[model samples]
Target: MIANFSQYGIKKLFLPITSVVLLVFGSCKDKAQEKPTEAMVEEVGTADGFESIFDGSTLNNWDGDPTYWRVENGSLIGEITPETLLDANTFIIWQGGEPSDFELKLEFRISENGNSGINYRSELLDTIPFALRGYQADIDGKHRYTGQNYEERKRTTLAYRGEKAEISTQENASEPESLRNNVQRNAWQSRKVLESLGHMDSLKTKINNDWNEAHLVVKGNTMQHFINGILMSEVIDNDSVNRNASGKLGMQVHVGPPMKVEYRNISLKQ
Candidate 1:
């Protein structure tokens, strides 16, 4: 009788131990089968109203010259290879709606000599294919022009890095196209620098060739550019005549030597 009872007790313990082992193995197997996801992608459905514009793996709703744009390793890349040099600036424009009052955020990394910019409140240039004329959040490899508010092919430089300025309408307004692309097109606009956000060199320390976050907050006549949470530049676009209230959004691969720029985590809050 004693031996029989001992055997029953051992059996009962073994069953529970075996069941626990099976459950452990099954849990691990299930987890291993699950695919990995990027943290940014996972946050797409979060409570925040910000929604991702880029799907990380595809450019389904984007328009650009395929020759210079592509997706690799979950990034939107634009490369101007030595063999595929460009004569004029090109862009990968977002096919989504032209957000008028919105906040834009993204992560970007550029090659040492790379020159790129984010165009907002912009319109497609009829004169040049893949070109834009509107407000730009300027970016470059050296951080020289990074965080600046430039009106590409339009009013020119609205505010430099570390500047808070107001762009007002000019009576005799018309900044004609010049031989140089960066030439000031303030013909019918006047910029009054309100104050210095900070020193250029001091603010530049917040940027690098590595991935960095850029934030653009444009509501009504006010536009703000932030690099890594620092207010780099701000512009009050009072130039109602030339200001673009709403238009397309695009990323630029400026005309220059061979260079590369990668963008990811593109989210917009309208």
Candidate 2:
């Protein structure tokens, strides 16, 4: 009887110890689960279907004036001093791939007087080294030119900010009823019409002197520009002769007073 009682007592002691061990292990497992998993972190990194192009340390697949462009503080910075001001605008061409249809996103900050743009569907001009000619998503320190669709070394200012334009040679640009209504040319001499997309006052408040997000969507002859989640401008390029099918990507350093521009989180999805 005593032997049986001692065996029962041993089992009772073992039961509590086992339960304690199980509880401790369960608590530890819960804590581990509370921490962020690798997959969760990866999801946050590439959540927007964007793949990073810049490695944030080196200029591997890019070509430009090294003196003006560099990777600093995890950003692609372009700085021009009064002494290093150029006679013409220059660009840093991305050699990764000439994406024809893709969504390009990045954050940019510029000092007052800075003039910069994101050039896509562009070509390097043989006339000038590191020069690009194509559609430019223009940005300026004055905030007057931000989000305008300007062509580099081509038909300039295809569509101004707060304009939804359908550019075609099929009909007279003067009468584009089939494409759009309430059309007004940005300039009397230009065929391109400036249709209002949104108010400039509303757009200006969204943009800040600090870092601002820029999202560009280009598909076929259609292009869109979004800043801070607001649709700034879009263009439907149907002018066959003037429309660019595919070309290189370039970042511009406009020739002007001393200024600086910094770009980071440069991503693209094709």
Winner by lDDT: 1
Residue-wise lDDT of candidate 2 within 170-205, one digit each (tens)? 444334343233233432123455578888767878
lDDT accuracy of residue 269 in candidate 2 = 95
Q: Write the per-residue lDDT of candidate 1 for residues 161-266, one digit (tens) a residue.
A: 9999988776545545421332444422378999999999999998976999999999999999999999999999887667889999999999888999999999
Number of clashes in model 1? 2
lDDT (CA) for every model shown? 0.87, 0.83
Per-residue lDDT of 180 in model 2: 37
Deviating ranges (above 4 Å) for candidate 1: 1-45, 174-189
Weakest ten-residue segment in model 1 by summed lDDT: 179-188
Give the backbone clash total of model 2.
Answer: 0
- How large is the C-alpha RMSD of every model relative to the true structure? 8.5, 7.3
Determine the C-alpha RMSD for candidate 1 after optimal superposition of all C-alphas.
8.5
Judged by whole-model lDDT over C-alpha atoms, candidate 2 comes out at 0.83
